[model samples]
Target chain A: MPKPMLKRSVQQTQTNNVLSVTGNQKQNNQNQQMNKMKIDKLLRQKRSKEYMDALHKLDVGGHVHNQNKVDEITNAIKREFPEVEISGILLGYVSICYLGKPYEVHTLDIASGIIEHYKSGETLPNGMEKARGIALHGGYEFIEVYVDCCRAVSSNGTVSVISI
Target chain B: MSDRVISQANLSYIERNLSAIHGEIQALENDVDAVNNNVKVVYDQVGVLANEFHEFVYEQKKANRLGQAEIKLVQIRQELEKKYGHYDIVRRTTTGILQADDLGIVKKTTISNATEELMISTPNYWLAPCLVALSAWISDQPELAEKALREGIKRNDEKTSLFFAIICMRANRKSACLKWAQRYLANQDEENLDRKAIIVIDAYANGLMGADTEGVISREMTKWLEELAEKPGFVEQQTTQWTEAINLKREPIENSGYTYLPKYSNTWPVLEDILEGANLHANILAYLMDIFEQESSSAPIKAQLDKILTSLVTDFDDEELPLRKKEKFEQFVVEFCGDEDRARQSMAIEETAFETHKDFTQLLTDAAMKPESSHASVATQKFAIALSKEWILNAYNDVIAQNRMKIPTEIEINVDTFNSKTTDGQNEAQLVNEFTQLVTKEKEAALAKNVLTGFDKFLLIGGAIIAVLGVGMIFGNPLGGFIAVIAGIGMVIKHFNKKKQLVINEENIKKNYEQKLENGLQIIRAILAEVVDFRIEFAEKDDESAKVVDFLEQITPDQYVKNLSTSNRRIKM
Candidate 1:
């Protein structure tokens, strides 16, 4: 019983509604993409304790020049922070080198190695050598190794509380 | 024909019905009183428990038992956390009892709802909103707290408005609070009791905002002192009492006759100790010298001012400091002005100033430490001593007034204006007697002002309904017009009666307000006199340190005229 113009108007409204719904879907997809990008950027910028520890281990591993030992530590880091995507890895003279996500990584296995050295009642320098091994194997350029309560070993081989 | 048909019984029936309604209203009033009492008792009990908890924590800390203190704190936090409601709705008794600072220990987002249900049935009571706002502030959610304050302000009551203004001031929204206070004062009657209270409150807020309080404070002090001079032995007694109290390291014994001591002595040793410190004196010197520097002059005062200023700049070299360090110094100044914990660093600046002005510094210190041995000149020194005490006491009162202004609770709002009428014969007198007992015990006159009028609307509505019923009867049958006429007359009579009672009630409240104002003024004067007495005694003891006084008098810069004469002599040479 509706007029022809009225019927056309109703049809036009339905079509517009469908278009708007698609538009909303597209907007939501863009938002999700933006959020993912933001998260990725933040992850890249963040320099956490794990990253510092990883760097320390890498520097110590370079000093020791043990390729197999360094490779094992890198594999351990790969399993720990799975969110980090690795780019490349290489073993060079006087250093077990690699390239990957600019983020920190340390595993339970690496932590236990440091803890065991402490359990043996060794001096801090001896325990730090264990931390250096993990850092070298992990190929971390900037890292920190937790030695004991309120103390940590940095890539510089300095044992102190975190201030900056 | 309708008038002729009017019956005496109809009129009697209307009167009887009206009487019954009055009885019901009285009963409702009694019920409200009982409920108010119950709420008060609960609040009092909670207050006691809170005090006990505070004492327990204090004891634990005093013993250096951190572990026990931590446990106790956690237990308190857990209890508050359990009763937490929605973030926006602060309508919970437990929320009121929970201190805002303690709420910081709990997780944010614990509360889930904006409760529409009022915590207390008392109209215009803002206890819940204040609690919620404080809790939100402690949680670092200022926006949410501000929203709660806005809601509290909607009550449109003077005490509530004043409370909000204080909160705003605390939040560092100084200009906003000032504007609100100005508007509040503007709206009040010139002679309103609340106006005087608001004036003191606003003045205090102004001081906190770093406004110069010297002008208003001087006027108030002069007025109070003049009034105090009339009271025999009052000033001398207060001075002795406060001096003794200070020596004993205890609060001054309150003499009921000297009621103003509390208000006047609010600043107590706090401001005096600050003035004694090197920093505040340096700041005052800096402020004074800065003023003279702006006004070009050839005088010894100007010369001395220039020396102090130049030394400060060269020694500190504060201008050349890095931007961040300069910012830190500015922050220190702000803290010092606020009298906050961080202001300790600002006080250090005073020590630096003292090093520069060693003689002046030593003089003040010696005067405070040394005793007066000038017994021969004691009578001569009395006037100077009293004058000096008055000046110092007024200055101290200024600081106290400003500090008290920062905390709104320091100023008490009088809410005892609500009183029952004696217009309803025996019933009216009985009601008045009942309310006097109830109100004195509960002390919630503002709440009474709001809830007590609830029955008036019902009475109005009942009278209208009776008239309507009479109209309905007449519309159905012409012979029933007499019933309608009687009902109409009854409605008019009741309406006039209620209106007259309202007018009388308003007059009574107005009279009470005037009386309370006078009483408030008297207390404030008493407070000023108390401090004057205490400071005078302290100055009397220091009067014996004549060497320092003589040194200060000789060394202090002479007038510009004298300096100009010296300059003329030099030019002649």
Candidate 2:
């Protein structure tokens, strides 16, 4: 009888050990699933916020950028060719030729200010310089050169430069 | 060891996939940022281009206006020259006659010899009437002049009639003068007269009579004088004689005074011719006095003549005098009083005459008020008034200039008011109104465009970013990211295309401006051509015409060359 009872006790202990191991594995799987879901949600939320911020920045930047370009063109035109009366603002990319080279100038008010020249090139400082150059050359070229300084402010408020 | 190995592999694979997704999202965000930046740049460029176009258009308008103004100025100058250039005629006549040795139709040894020979050789039937007419006219014989005129007319000899008319006019036989003048004018054909003969006839008829005729008479006289003055050969001699005459100097006679006496010798062949006349010497003296009285510088001579005329007027009774003499004397008084002061006095007479002889006064008033009559009278009167005014104004101007006086307070104030009224206040008010309308429209357009561009740029960037993030959220959304990139590129292309179209529109406007300028120049050229023709005709002299032609030539070449040069420059540019 003593021999049989010892065997039974050993079997019971083995079963209890198996059950505890299974419970521990299940708890660990649930915790891993929950952590994965939490991480995915946080990442999506961060990405959306970044996109929203970028979009807002872009909108504000566009307005500021346009305004800055106008100011730069106006200043450049005023400085280079002071005689050209500024009349009003207009919009578009205005390319002006200065000193035989073409440069693009941006302006918000075209009706108010006098544009010296038109050409295709990189950004220029003033419309008047191109006009002056054309005048000096007896209007020989297709473009006018303005001798003016322009103020440009970046949209991000990071850069401000004067072109002359 | 086996379980640990399985977990590590799975974790590593998931981490690699997540990193790839995150990389894609970053790439998409960068693409959006680039698009946004590009849109901003394009917007700025468009603004500048628009401004340049506006300036170009304005300059073109200004140039057109200036060209038009210059053309108008040229036209006005030509018109003024045409209207006022004829005043140089009177100075020509005095000089031409002063230098003539023989005032005969044909060259002769002497004017008197020619006259006597012509009178003697002519047939008695023809000669007798001409002699009587000439004698009567020279002696201011009123009844004999009428009889002589009638006899000449019955014979129907135009040449003799013309001679009688000229003589009668010179003698101041106003009635006989008018009758013969009317008869001669009625018989004459203008086409038959050469310019020189016409000039001589005009000078004799108009200049000697001092008729105060206007229109064709005055115009022709002025034209003749202008032509004569411009002749280098005649100008100096004529001007010198005029100055001498005006200064009351004894002018040199080309022939001795008696040598030319034969012109009147035939008419006085018998003692009866001189003695049987009605105070022939007194008539000659009276005629001379009449001519001198109107133009005399000596006040006493004018006063004496006035007294004589006044006495004659008071002494003569209208019914008691012979009909012919009464008619002749009345015509003389009417003509004499037709001068400037007389005209003013006659206005009062006109009003009184209207009351007593209403029918006659109405007829006379109607004649005076007629446009043709006013045209004839007003032209001369205005010219005289203008001459007097110009003289006074010039003298006043000289005084003002010499004194260096400040402008009068009244004038200064008026000028200030005029400037402010016409220029500052008026123009500013107009400009403000126009500008307000323009700005409101333009600003609205600009704002709309700006917002649209901003929204488009934002959408392009935002969509790309969102697509990239979505792809990362899903396992691998490559298709979505690819679609976003395509849309962004399309948006950029669309924006660029829009900008290009705007540039084209601006170019079209510039082209239109150039076309308008060309059209305006053509109109100006046409106007200038008309002015040139008018100036040439108006100048009416060989030398003046030549000078005008030269001036026109100079202007034409310069204008044509300027136009060609500008066109060539435009092509080159």
CAPRI class assigned to model 2: incorrect
Worst 10 residues of 1 chain A by lDDT: A87-96
TM-score of chain A, all candidates: 0.27, 0.20
lDDT of 2 by residue, B1-573 (tens): 999999999999999999999999999999999999999999899989888988777666655544554555455445533542221121122122212422423232332343334434433334345545444433446686567557656665554555444444444543454455444544544324322222223222223323423333334434444554343333223323322222231223333222212222221122122121212223323322333234212222223323422332232222323432323333333444323344346545643532322221122122222325322122222222222222222222222111111111111001100111111122334433443454445445544443335655566566556555655645566677666666656666666665666667656655654454454334333333333342232223212222322322232111110010111000000
Candidate 1 off by > 4 Å: A1-164, B1-122, B126-158, B175-207, B213-230, B242-388, B391-544, B547-573
Error of 2 at A129 (Å): 54
- What lDDT does candidate 2 reach at residue A105? 28
User: What does DockQ give for each predicted structure?
Assistant: 0.00, 0.00
**What's the lDDT for residue B297 in model 1?**
29
How far does residue B127 in candidate 1 sit from its true spot (Å)? 6.3
